[model samples]
Target chain A: MEPDTQNGGGMAKLGIWLVVLLLIIGGIVVYGKRGEDTKKASVKEPIKIGFIGPLTGDLANIGANTKAAVEIGVDDINSAGGIGGRTLEVVYEDSQCTPAKSTSAANKLISVDKVAAILGDTCSSATLAIAPIVEQAKVPLISYASTAAKVSDAGDFIFRTVPSDVLQSSFAAKYAVEKLAKKKVAIIFVNNDWGLGLSKGFSEAFKAGGGEAVFSEGIDATSKDARSLLSKIKAIKADILYLLVMPGQAEIVIKQAQELSLKISIFGADPLEDMTVWNNAGKAGEGVMFTTIGTSPSDDFKAKMKAKVGSDEIIYSGPFAYDGLKILGKVIGEVGTDGTAIKDALYKVSYEGGVSSPKIEFDQNGDPKEAGYAIKIVKNGKPVVVK
Target chain B: MDIVPQLIANSIIAGSIYTILALGFNLSFSTGKFIDMGYGVMMVIGGYAVFYLSKILGLPLPVGILLGLVISGLVSYLAYTVVYKPLRARKASGAVLLIASLGVLTALQAVIAILFTSQFQTLSGLLSGNRVFEIFGGAITAVQLTTLALGIFLFVILAVILKYTMCGKAVTAISDDEEVSKIVGINTEKIIGSVFFISGVIGGLGGMLIGFDTGIEPIMGLPWLLSAVTAVIIGGIGNVYGSIAGGFLLAFAENFGIWQIPGEWKSAITFGILILFLLFRPRGLFPK
Candidate 1:
């Protein structure tokens, strides 16, 4: 009776193995069939593009805002039936606002992802780091926020929706000298591409306009103590203090400057458009004037961004980022995904009624033509546009 | 340079903060006999605790501060028990313990970032207003002056306690020889645990004061840690007074060093001194 039971158990085990084998065979066949289906569906494959930004670092706030705006651009493109029935998709990579990381991210996007075009690298250093690579690959890259003046000569394939610091620096320098009647300016900037570019340009412009640059110094990005620098500037008796620092450091500099009783007119670049800096600085940031890229989002775009980000306050580059992706879509629609073709077509592609600017047109340097600038002053704990 | 007075004031303020940091780190280092790299994050923990409790939860300033100190102390004690103690029982090498402390530092910093969203915050905003003080033709803030006083006060209190108290004797014995200390009827584990708690409190105080003076970030501890470690080594690693002297010396070198150069070279000047000390004066300026 025991032997008979054992034989019955063996027979049951054999039956179970047979069923499992059959199921494995069936799964492979089903999976292979789905794979073929995907191949057939390639006709409707999405248009691929790459995006690079500082997703998780000191500059992450800017990255988050620009990334959301780009996502909105992708949504807008798809909802409008996409470009020639193919949906738009973006491959996002975090550069962390460093040149080395940006280079690696660009390489991955170009080689691994094989994206048709690239949209970002929010920091000027990151953009410059990848410019030669994109230029070599003949890939057209457009920047949404980088404003460093040297970006104008980075590469022919490089383009930016925002104007270069050359324009903004001259604008600010003129305003400081002519409008504010400030003769002596002390320039302290973060020792990075953005700060270096803006500070040097502003100093040159100010000096050329018959204003004296009493002192110009560079500090590390993570520096929290500015007492010595402030004291030196104060001793030199500068009437205007132009700060070219990241938003976080801006608060420290302003507060420390206030504590030392070095009361002077404080000015900054576009990065100060952030309300977080003013809020952190509190009353210390009062009357701090800064220059930012001039562009107004349309009501429709503003409403979309509000619903998308759940806040009416869009980042300063939000409209520019949306316009950048949309312009790429338009260019890709006119010309196929060929790199040089896209590069050539971007110059001819004149987009009007865009959210960032009223009209977007690329010039000889691949920069937007005649981009305007706006001056904002911190008042009562908020940045109010004065010009 | 007419900026001499301000430079001196800046050095003193920065030096005091570093002195406080060095004192906390040396206490834990002496007792544990291993570099507690994780000691730096205690400052971040304390600063963030107060920021959340007082700034966000609307708790009273003193209550928030006391709770913050306790929280940091508890975290340090837990780290010692759950990580360092177990590793020490297994006879881990100094290198192994150092790496473990690094892991602790990275993990705690990430946790803080996740909770606070990595935004820089200032506790000074909660104060009604900031008062400026003048000294010898140099302007100093009320916060800076208080930070200076606290650093000196902590140094004296620690010096007295370590020289006279029974707990201090036990810690010194353990630091000298842990096995010998255990065989001599000393409760080594309990004493080390308490030492870690004290270290955390001192580190937390430094952090809170810096937050009020400048601001706070999860990454803030690393730079401060680098400075303190350099101070500890240069001041004679186990000597309490060495840390104070080393802290002030490094600050003076850094502040005055940048007088003729660009401010961007400040860190370069600091690490340069550190490397010189490591090569020429490994036992430090005040070697025991």
Candidate 2:
């Protein structure tokens, strides 16, 4: 074989370098043109809503759905003569539900995006992660569906569209007793502040409602063995199972319960509304039920969502997100993006057609108070309006 | 005595799953001298395979298990050949490899989410079919029994291959010193590739077993990796038998830790113990 020559400043190297530079320039021109179109449409200077969630992790489904819903909401608001005569724009950052990511996003939303009022950072820990930043920055932060009681209690600057676990669990236990008519229950909750907190509220409420949480079991969010968890449930012999799971394990408990041959009804929080769980559960999910704030705003609202966003993929929290923007837009209209004025104005803005829940009034703790819930059953593989 | 029998049974069930991960994790790690964050992603692929087959395709659970194993194993091999081989050829450092693995991890994780949509799903096999055995104060399910059986089976096969097979000797040679083994008669390239395949198989099997027990979620991999790593380290890395010991110890610490204080503190306790070991005895409980 002939001896191979090293790259002695060959023309081939120069040709390759020239192509690389051309590709970079081409990419920039394409992106810049798209940016210009958006700017011409006046989207660049629109009223901004900063949002955060785990856009690409275990919490992706819930976050993606919420993002989609908010996009629809903003589009609807903007097209309808815009909010406060200003087009609404939403900027999103992925928190991945890590505290570090949440803090960075929260700071960026305040200091960088300069959003008047912010939304989301789904996980309770994440919301708590950014709580101090939002509070100190005086940016009125509205979390759509996080329900750890600590969220509303974090401070006055933090307001949530979803009811706290305090209300959700009491309402859940009430449904179990009054609706499902089951006395003994198995509480299988993900082991976290969120799970433990919901379990506590449900336990207290269930006992108060003349029922007992026979066996309350905890599994780490990363647990792999539902057999042990199910065996313990079988051991308890609960008449009904209350699973407080993240989107990760919600379907697991449902199917594993089928394996254990325990035919008890499974009730969970709104996180169970995830399409993955619904699709995974399939026929097994026929009798399953969970609590949400309320049903879709109206048939027309849903039809609009179906046309604008993908309907079958809609989760419970999206409607609430739309309501969040509408509510914030009103606040901005009244107070003109001043955090103090917006924060004070939020308590006074009363709007009908609030998504997911009933009424929009902040309780002493900044959680929505006295909201009716939506409890639907999966009939024929679809969530039928079962009152 | 009631708790003891149950604890022993529970420990074995948990240990079996962690063993699959630890054994596979240590094997490639010892020889290649690089960690594969993508191993967890391989487990997710295995899990999704089983779920799609058994649930959607309506295939039998056994077929699903085979499919999951084959799919995940092939994916792992292809990933190494495509993404890792070039990096290793260029003599990339360990940190660069870690970052590359993370990239693979992120991309694989995204693909799984896009396909399954981040829902918790399970394998539908009668292997767990509501069969209950009341053993003492605690009752163990059929699936738990099967998991124990699977663990023992893998351990036995691992022993046979490692102690009595030629490829096993080659693996040992490489683990001892990859550079020295390459200079010797052993084909280091072939051995390294085979090690990755076997490790991938272990990961796939782990997903199947865990899928039967709990449920399979994309995010499920991190916790499994953490447990397996803890077991490997505590039992002595690269020591397969020692990992089984480490698995039990870790499970026991997690479960019974709740007994002393509020049960929610189990994780705090588990991590606290992990930190203690790290600070005082990072060599692990059964250091090789």
Candidate 3:
């Protein structure tokens, strides 16, 4: 009976493998036919570029806003005579704002999609995760939202529309000490490259500006509970609590801190620009301020995003995404869809009247050449820039 | 020094949530005799059900919660009948059952994400404000207090039922020896079905409380699953009362262990204790 059962199991395994082999062969035939179809339609076969962002998970809202902006950018370019007679298209992949997922997405885009250039990976961690992959693949990887200082050194092929945290942290430190009269700060950041970079930069800048970092610690990015961590921060009695967290979790931190009645002013980084933080946090988010890279998305762009997304609320990164796509479209149009040529063209390209910035250009290290900082405060369920 | 009281309060609050999770997990595992990874998605089902009914459809919160429990229970029972039971009838190995459950977990989680769009949502909007209470210099919200009370109440009720009820006796008999239980004319499948339902109800309650306390996301259940499983192992696998003890102990150790260390060390501390127990006392503190 045992030998009979073993033979039956072997047959089943063989049958499964046969089915798998057939499926693989069928897939290759379909995929090969599709490639030929694209070649046949070569006259206007659309310049396909890849996009990686947090389309799902904790940061999905921010991704949604940015994605809407990118969609608008694509629409705008297509309407303007199809980017030198070839319509531009975007192939988007969800990274879930995780490094591991971002790496896999990058590999898929590079190997399978074979995109001319790649855009996005909104989170700094995700951008960094795909940096080596893109560098090795020689893909011109342009990010709209990632701002960690480490990203500047990721690779020659890596570029971002957003300014590094190095500039923002120093700007925030100067503002806190000089404008707000805040001396001692307690830092609680999500334990990721973005958070660590901001905390380290802020602490160093604050110390240089004649202020003290009273307490600092890192927590898991996905932590739901912050009471104990808050308790520890509360014990320090710092004047300001500088929290670096993602959007969805930031609301919880604000609400929990309010519940704990921590008697310190709260400050945050760019992620607080998300409307979800303001809406979900409600009263708790009132008066909370955050530093973000300055952007002035055109009024027309704002109207388009509102009409598209059913809301006028724009994530701070939205304009950068819009600008990033526009830049990519221009460079790809001029450089003829070669990744190396696009990367070289990007370094010399200059744009005026972009939604993100008045003039956009990339420096030697692929950092944004023109970076301005704005401090925005949440009041009455909206973020208003503080002049 | 002043932070100690709050830390203790925080520990208790965390412990209570873990206890609730461990209880549901332990009850189901004792009867099924296989690690049901899909058990976690039952909480997501409940949480999303409540979110849809209460938040979107504007149903009364109580009605939504009750229906959430019903839906969660039905899903859990269906999983057993549709998936596990047929496989059990085929005499599938425990590992195969575990892998099947993992498939259920992934598929259900993906469905929830597609339905709800994977945003972190809060149920506390039903209340005008989550009232905060001070206990030993630590602040806990009304939702957390409710969770703590529910944890204790469920523990007592479960203890009573398991100790005295006929269905409980049948479950015990089956867990002890399924073949012997069948020979004794006990309907093991029906009893196990009910066991899964009860666990599902407990999991739904936990999901609601956690939703009110923190928030709900599709992936939220995975973390709670890990925490609860750790609690069950540390307390004593298959031991009902030990889940409570292990939950509190694990929470306390995690909360206090990071007093002088960074909060990022919490997971490490949790697993460190888990490893210590596995190495020294694989049967757990209160061996069943």
Per-candidate TM-score against the hidden true structure = 0.91, 0.81, 0.95
Question: What is the C-alpha lDDT profile of model 3 across B176-255, one tens digit per residue?
Answer: 88899999999989999998888888888898888888788999888889899999999999898889999999999988
Q: Which pairs of residues collide in candidate 3?
A: none
DockQ of each: 0.46, 0.19, 0.68
What lDDT tens digits, residue by residue, belong to model 1 across residues A315-376?
Answer: 77778888999999999998878999999999888999888888999998989996888889
Candidate 1 residue spans exceeding 4 A from truth: A1-41, A133-138
- Candidate 3 per-residue C-alpha lDDT over A331-387 given as tens digits, one digit per residue, 9 for 90 to 100: 888878878999999999997889988998999999889898889998898888898
What ranking emerges by TM-score with the best candidate at the front?
A: 3, 1, 2
Per-residue lDDT of model 2, residues A132-203, tens digit only: 888898999888877898897788889888777888889989989988788998888887678888999998
In model 1, what are the clashing residue pairs, if there are any?
A: none
Candidate 3 iRMS, in Å?
1.3
